[model samples]
Target: MDKKNIKKVVLAYSGGLDTSIIIPWLKENYNNCEVIAVAADVGQGSGELEGLEEKAKKTGASKLYIADLKKQFVEDYIWETLKADAVYENKYLLGTSFARPLIAKRLVEIAQAEGADAICHGCTGKGNDQVRFELSIKAFAPNMPIIAPWREWNIQSRDEEIDYAEAHNIPLKITRETNYSKDKNLWHLSHEGLDLEDPANEPQYNKPGFLELGVSPEQAPDKPTYVTIHFEKGVPVSLDGQKLCAVDLLSQLNKLGGENGVGLADIVENRLVGMKSRGVYETPGGTILYHAHNKLEEICLDKDTYHYKQGIGEKFAELVYDGKWFTPLREALSAFVDSTQGTVTGDVKLKLYKGNIIDAGVTSPYSLYDEEIATFSADDVYDQSDADGFINLFGLPLKVQALKKLKLGK
Candidate 1:
């Protein structure tokens, strides 16, 4: 907490009220040190980035760094999650959860370049993001000092933050009544706060400023929509025969899937810090990708490998959710995922309608589903008489237990 020796501090600035206030607060409290702001553009869009440099300057930052991380965000972080088939608690796509590490990494880079004595963030102490940011910083740059203003400052509530912004002449994106905590990027949009904190309360999508991305299922189109997703080596390559880039492919899929009301999940998941919080997320493209990828895995992977890979998927989700992104276990699990996906090249057709994903078709060159061997009809692919010995050996435990009971009774 010593600010006397600090000549400069680099802040992970979002241009939000909290981060806007931190720039001035650091200067005032940290012996008038220079504050450099870093706004990471991880596909939250150019709109949020617009006027960000000017805003940071106006808010007393000596310099501002706006790093465009959209393409890298999707290809490296989001697609990796897709490849692993990692879903937190069978629902969450880890949208905001995965974004923090990339942002923090850039924060450290800027901090080192700026020669700042410490790095700062606007995340509050209560939320999961604080953990995600700090843990990532520790993993990447262990010796760097992290200054969390919310954990240290006197501002205790969002109302106090707004008041501080007003007193300090800071421009903000939300007011007290209109604010709903939202995290947005190319992959998904997450809505929290307002009525969502209460588990008994149903969502009020009809209210203005309550929803994002697109319409809800009750407001979706009546007709069903079908699309084919082609994958090579576990990465989605095309949509409906059109070969698109990763970002464009996901964008097109989101538009189509959103129209059909493909994805909307409401869950109160357990956080790593021993608390359950409710969040409403809309991940249109991710839902579709998960289905197609899982379907390909079914036909491509063998019995034991497929079942065991399922366990690895769960562990991967946990590690990612817990912010253990730099660990060896995640890398080892990714290796297993990569090996299982060697034969996962195929296309899966899915029908989306009214918040449901239906499997329409699936085909793969390495599919183990031979109709001749699996059919019950008369065929020369296998002799039916050969099953007697196979069944006896397969059920040997049952046969031995039954014979033991018979001998005891006699």
Candidate 2:
């Protein structure tokens, strides 16, 4: 891909620090090419999107396209991951991990629609997002050329990028003191960099201007907050007694869960890029939903299926974390997950106290928990004499080995 031949380039713009400077960088490096900035709105809130068009144009973008992908993001990507019960490294809810592919897919669509010569992104070379975006791009448009400025440009650090931005006269909302790298969507808000880079430093959740979603557990209310989530075939369809849309349900949960300090995680996780990175995630709504869903599955699914699905959940997590959402294996695993969810319709009541989620009750029409047979008192369903034959057959090998050893004891 020659630079001179590239006439137009479509950029996955977020109006953040890296992307704010990338608009000008693209134009200068590509002979003043027509840079079309495309921002995907996956419920990062209006605050992030406010005045974005003006900012893009001011930074030398020929045009800006903001795609409203909130519904699709939750319904398609978030729900699928939720149904699969995927959790990366036993901690990360994959708020940022799964978002890249959806954003990148939209970028490819816009690039092809606009007849652009190349696609560009602001993902750093060392991070997992670069791989995620590039892999999705390759899956969609195999031959399309990609331009990653962080890898191509000579800027070595965020400080250098800031210097470049200042030199280019780009007005930024953040300075060095406040420039903690963050990624936020409807599901979660992640904080990394600055003091958070070191594993020893504890997260300043109680500090002002540190936490955006919820307070620390120490600040949570003394009384526990009870929440009832209704699931229909594995997907949450209602909160309390009211049925709501996916986005609305999640939004309401976020408000409730945030108020009670339900979801705050500090993890030093292994990145797909081969290094351990520390990040603090605030996922109030998602945490509540995951807990409720698991509780529902406990009663609905049989023991064998429930245990087997745990391994599937783990694999599903790895695949999503590694940015393999568009792959065949993930699709097959999702099919299996969906099959298991046929009986997952139920209502789960939870007690949220500080950072803990306690199960209050779980009820499902398809529940296999037979209280009559499982009762300690005498019951006609399970005969007491049946256990004698069952135990003998079950322990036949052990009994035979013991008898042989006794007979050979000269």
Candidate 3:
């Protein structure tokens, strides 16, 4: 690829220190190609988007394209993940990992529509997002050249990035000593870097940069707070019965869950590149959504279907984490997820307090639970005599092993 042939480039810019500097660097290195900055508003906040166009222009980007993808992000990506009960390493809600593909998809769309010659991003070579972003680009537009400045440039660290931004007059709001590096959206908020880079040291919740969602659990209210989440076909449609859109529902849940100091996680997770990194996450809405959706599935799904789907859920999490969202395997896994979610229409009641999700009640038209059969003092719904044959068949292998052991001893 000739540097002179590249006329224009679209960058997945975030208006952060790294991306702000990237606009100028791309222009400098790519034969002064026109750099168009595209920032996806995946419900990070309007505060971050405020004056973004002006910021881009001030930082030397020819233009800035801000796409409001909050609703679509939640409905398409977040809810799709929620339906599968997808959680990476049994803990992480994958806030940052999931957003890359959608952002890259939009980047591809914008690039094709604008007739841009190349696409670029600020992700470093070591991180998972570099893989996620590039893989999505390959999946959608394989011919488009990807310009990863971090992997190519001399900027070695965030400190060097800060120095570059300062020298170039990029107007960065962050400092080098901040305790955490955060990524936020409607689904979740992630915190990495700083002391979190050291696995042995636990995160300090009291620091200014460390806390955002709410007060720490130690400072949370003592009593439990109850909330009801309504789901229609596995999509969260409302809170406590009031109909709301995807963004609105997530907003309300974040507020409620945050007030109670819920949705905080400290995890040492395996990165896609096979390294373990410690991160603290705040996933208020995603926490509520995953738990509630699972509660609804408990009522809606049968035994074999439920157990088998659980296995699929684990695999689904792996595929998403590994940036296989646009692949055939992901589509097949989603098909299985969708099939299981057909009857998963219902509501879940939950109690939130001090970072805990507690069960209140779950109700669904397709509920598998039968109180009559499960009751200790039961009637014709279930016969006690049936247990003898059932246990005999179910435990045949164990019984035969015990008999063989006894015979050997005699």
Candidate 4:
């Protein structure tokens, strides 16, 4: 927390409102420390990254480093989350959750390389990103000092942040009326704050610019769109029939899923800081991928493994959401998840209609579904008489307990 010790600092900058102001704030408060801005290109699109270097320099940063993390983001973080089926609170897809650790790790690397005395982030004190960034930084550089401007600054609100930016002549792209906080990546786009803060307020999806990645279901086409996804050991390898790299595959799916209004979720989720927050997420490609992967698992994984994996998925979601990505438990859980995905290779066709994803077909080479055993009609593979014994043995404990209760009655 000592300002004198920080002669140089590496900042996780996005060229956003918070980070734009932090450049000058760091210089001012840290005795004119040099701020090296670091931006992670995790598929947030060119619009957010374009002209970022110029902006950072104009705002007082000595230099800007934009790391192209799209391939790693999709292949390493996004794919791993998909394989684990880890959805936070049965709603959130953990798009922003996992990206934080990756960005923070890069920040640590940049700090070490630059021989900086400290790491800085724009994440606010009340949100989850602070914990996520700090935890990942601590894991990589335990002794590195972290300066969170939001936690130390006098700015109380977004309005005040804008005032400070204007006072300092820092240009911003947002106005008071359009200042809804947002996070975007290849996996999803989340909209929060402003009108979304109230749980009762329905998302203004119909409003212009409210939904960036897609449209409202009401605005979707009447005709349904069918798409086929191919997976190899639980990783999506191709869309329809053409094989693609991880980034390209997900990009194509995002276009298809967004056009059909495939992934739109409005959720009130519990934050790691112990507060409920509402957010509307657009995860078009990710939603389709999850649906297809789960369908493939239905035929591939056994009942015991599939059911048990559901629990593991929930816990995994919690760990990812809580910023424990570098912890031993999360690594162990991911190992277990990987073991379950050995046979999760297949193709799943889905029909997307007005925000609903309907199953068209599913096929897997390692499918455990045996038609003869499952058939209700006459089947030699599974004898009907076997059910009589199974029922008797399965109900033995219940039957004995009932009999004992009957004997004790009067």
lDDT (C-alpha, whole model) for all candidates: 0.86, 0.92, 0.86, 0.94
Give the candidate number with the greatest lDDT.
4
Q: lDDT, candidate 4, residue 244?
A: 99
Model 2: CA > 4 A from native: 400-410
Model 1 scores a C-alpha lDDT of 0.86
Model 4: what TM-score? 0.99
Question: How many collisions per candidate?
Answer: 0, 0, 0, 0
Q: What is the lDDT of residue 109 in candidate 2?
A: 96
Which tens-of-lDDT digit does each residue in 1-410 have in candidate 2? 79998999999999989999999899889999999999999988999999999999999998999999989999999999999889988888999988999999999999999999999999998899999999999999999999999989999988888898899998887899988999999999999999999999999989988888888888889999998999999999998899999999999998888888889999999999999999999999999999899888888888899999999999999998898989999999999999999889989999988888899999989988899989998788988888999999999999999999999993
Scored against the true structure, residue 219 in model 1 reaches a CA lDDT of 76
Q: Where does candidate 1 clash, by residue pair? A: none
At residue 349, candidate 3 shows an lDDT of: 96
Best by TM-score: 4
| Prediction 4 global C-alpha lDDT | 0.94
Tens-digit per-residue lDDT, 1-410, candidate 3:
78898989999988887788998898899998998999999988888888899999887788899988887888888888888888899999878877888999999999999999999999877789889999999999999999999888999888888888888878876888872567878777888897788888877876554667776777779998999998888888989889998889889998888878888899998888888888888887788888999899888889999899888988988988988889899889888888888788888999998878899999988788888888888478877899999999999999899999999995
TM-score (all chains, Cα) for each model = 0.95, 0.97, 0.96, 0.99
lDDT of 1 by residue, 264-340 (tens): 88989998888888988888888889989999989988999888877788888888888877779988888878878
